[model samples]
Target chain A: EPEVTQTPSHQVTQMGQEVILRCVPISNHLYFYWYRQILGQKVEFLVSFYNNEISEKSEIFDDQFSVERPDGSNFTLKIRSTKLEDSAMYFCASSQTTEAFFGQGTRLTVV
Target chain B: AQSVTQLDSHVSVSEGTPVLLRCNYSSSYSPSLFWYVQHPNKGLQLLLKYTSAATLVKGINGFEAEFKKSETSFHLTKPSAHMSDAAEYFCVVINSGGSNYKLTFGKGTLLTVNP
Candidate 1:
C-alpha cells in the first residue's frame, strides 16, 4: 500500500533557529494536514492544505508557523523561530477521500 | 463542536484473549469515526473507520468497530489479542462532515497484550 513519507525522522534545532519539516503525500491524495503531539499527550491538529492553499488551521498554528505545498508532491511545514515548547512529534497526513493516512512522523527537538 | 473520548486510559489482556477498547463521540453533523493504532515510536496506523455506511466496520489485523449512533460510541474489538496488538489506540472524529477535514482526537488508550 502507498504511504505518506516524511523526511528527517529526527531533528535537533536551536530555539531561535528556523526549521522546516518535509512530507511527500500519497500521489493521488487531494488533501494534506499537519498534526503534532507533545510526549504522552493527545494528537493536536495544526493545519490543513488543499489546492495549494491552507483550508484551515488550529489555534496552535500561529504566526510563526506556515505550510506550503511548494510542488505537486512535497508539502512542507516551516517554523520561523522555534521555541523550546516547539519540541514534539510532527505528523504529516494525506487523504484521497474522507479518511486521512499518516506518515511515520518527524521528531523535532529544540534546545 | 466535534470530539472523541476514549473511556479507558489503559487496558491489559493476555494473548489469545478478547480485547475491547471503548470510545464515545459527539458531532453536530453525521459523524465519521475512526480508530488508529500507534506502536511505540511509530506513526499512527488506521485500524478501522465508520462512515455511516455500516454499523460494524472490520479492518486489518482482525480488528473491528461498531458504530452505535444511539449510544454515540464506536468501540474497537478483537476476537483474540496477539502480542503484536500492544499499542496506543486513538479514537478520532472528523469535524463538520469533512468540511475542513480536521480531526479531533481522543486522549487515547494504551493496550498491553501479555503472554
Candidate 2:
C-alpha cells in the first residue's frame, strides 16, 4: 500500500538554529497534516494543509512554525528558531478520504 | 469537541489468551472513530476505523473493534493474542461533518503479550 514518507529519520540541531522537516505525502492525497509527540506524551496536532494553504492550526503551532507545499509531492515544516522544548517526534500524515496515514516520523533533538 | 479515553494504561496477557483494550468516547455529533497501533519507535498504523458503517469492524492481524453508540465506546478485541501484538494502542475520534478533521487521541494503552 502507498504510504506517507518523511526524510531525515532523525535530526540533531543546536538550539536557536532553524530546522526544516520534509515529507512526501501519498501522490493522490489532498489533505496533509503535521503532529508531534513529546517523549511520554500524547500526540498533538500542529497544523493541517490543503490546497496549498493552512486549513487549521492548534495553539501549539505558533509563530516559529510554518508549512509549505513547495512542490507537487513535497511538504515541509520549517521552524525559525528551535528550542529545547521543540525536541520531539514529528509525524507527517496524509489523507485522501477519511482514513489518514502517517509517516515513520522524524525524531528532532535540540541541544 | 470530541475526545477519546483509553480505560487501561497497560494490559498484559499470554500469547494464547484473548485480548481486550477498552476505549470510551464523547462527541456532540456522529463521530468517526479509529484504533491505531504503534510499535516501539515506529509510526502510527491504522488498526481499524468506524465511520458509522458496521458497528463491528474487523481490522488487520486479527484485531477488531465494536462501536457502541449508546455506551459511547469503541473497544478493540482479539480472540488470541500473539507475542507480536505487543505495542501501544491509541483510540482516536473526529467529528464526521466538521470542516476541521483534527483527531483527538487518547493517551494510549501499552499492550504486552507474553509467551
Candidate 3:
C-alpha cells in the first residue's frame, strides 16, 4: 500500500530559529493536512490544504506558521521563530476524498 | 462541536482473548467514525471506519466496529487478541455532513496484550 512519507524523523532547533518540516503525500491525494501532538496530549489539527491553498486553520496556527505545496509531490510546514511550545510530533496526512492517510510524523524539538 | 470519548485509558488482555475498546461520540449531524491504531514509533493506521453505509463495519486484522446511532457509540472489537495487537487506539470523529474537514480524536486507549 502506498503511504505518506515525511523527512527528517527528528529535528532539533534553537528557539527563535526557523524550521521547515517536509512531507510527500500519496501521489493521487487531493487534500492535505497537518496535525500536531504534544507529548501525552491528544492530536490537534493545525491546518488543511487543498488546491494550493489553505482551506482551514486552527487558532494554534498563528502568524508564525505557514504551509506550502511547492511542487506536485512535496508539502511543507514552516515555522518562523520557533518557540519552546513548538516541541511536538507533527504529522502530515493526505486523502483523495473522505479518509486520510497519515505519515510516520516528524518530531520537532525546540530548545 | 464534535468530539469523541474513549471510555478506557488502558486495557490488559491475555493472548487469544477477546478484546473490546469502548468509544462514545458527540456530533450534531451524521458523523464519520473511525478507529486508528498506533504502534510504537509508527504512524496512526486506520483500523476501520463507519461512513453510514453499514452499521457493522469490518476492517483489516480481524477488527470490526459497530455504529449505534441511538447510543451515540462506535465501539471496536476483536474476537481474539494477539501480542502484536498491543498499541494505542484512538477513536476519531469527522463531521462529513458539515463543511469542516477537521477530525476530532479521543484521548486514546492503550492496550497491552500478555502472553
> For all the predictions, what are the DockQ values?
0.79, 0.72, 0.65
Query: Which residue segments of model 2 deviate by more than 4 Å?
Result: B96-100
Q: Please report, as a value between 0 and 1, the fraction of native contacts recovered by candidate 1.
A: 0.78
| Native-to-model Cα distance after best TM-score fit, residue A66 in candidate 3, in Å | 0.5
Query: Listing every candidate in turn, what is its Cα RMSD in Å to the true structure after a full C-alpha superposition?
Result: 1.1, 1.0, 1.3
| Candidate 3 interface RMSD, angstroms, 1 decimal | 1.6
Once model 2 is optimally superposed onto the true structure by TM-score, how far is the C-alpha of residue B77 displaced, in angstroms? 0.4
DockQ of 1: 0.79
Residue range B8-68, candidate 3, lDDT tens digits? 9999999999999999999888889999999998899999998889899999999999999
Q: Report model 3's TM-score to 2 decimal places.
A: 0.96
TM-score of each: 0.97, 0.97, 0.96
What lDDT score belongs to each candidate, Candidate 1 first?
0.93, 0.93, 0.93
Runs of candidate 3 with Cα error greater than 4 angstroms are B97-100
Worst 10 residues of 2 chain B by lDDT: B94-103
Model 1, residue A6: distance off in Å is: 0.2
Over B1-115, each residue of candidate 2 has an lDDT whose tens digit, in order, gives: 7899999999999999999999999988878999999999999999999998899999999999999989999999999999999999999996434344777789999999999
Alpha carbon lDDT at B109, candidate 3: 94
Q: Give TM-scores of chain A for all candidates.
A: 0.98, 0.99, 0.99
Write one digit per residue (lDDT tens) for candidate 1, span B1-115: 8899999999999999999999999877779999999999999999898888989999999999999888988999999999999999999998743445888999999999999
Among these predictions, the greatest lDDT belongs to: 1
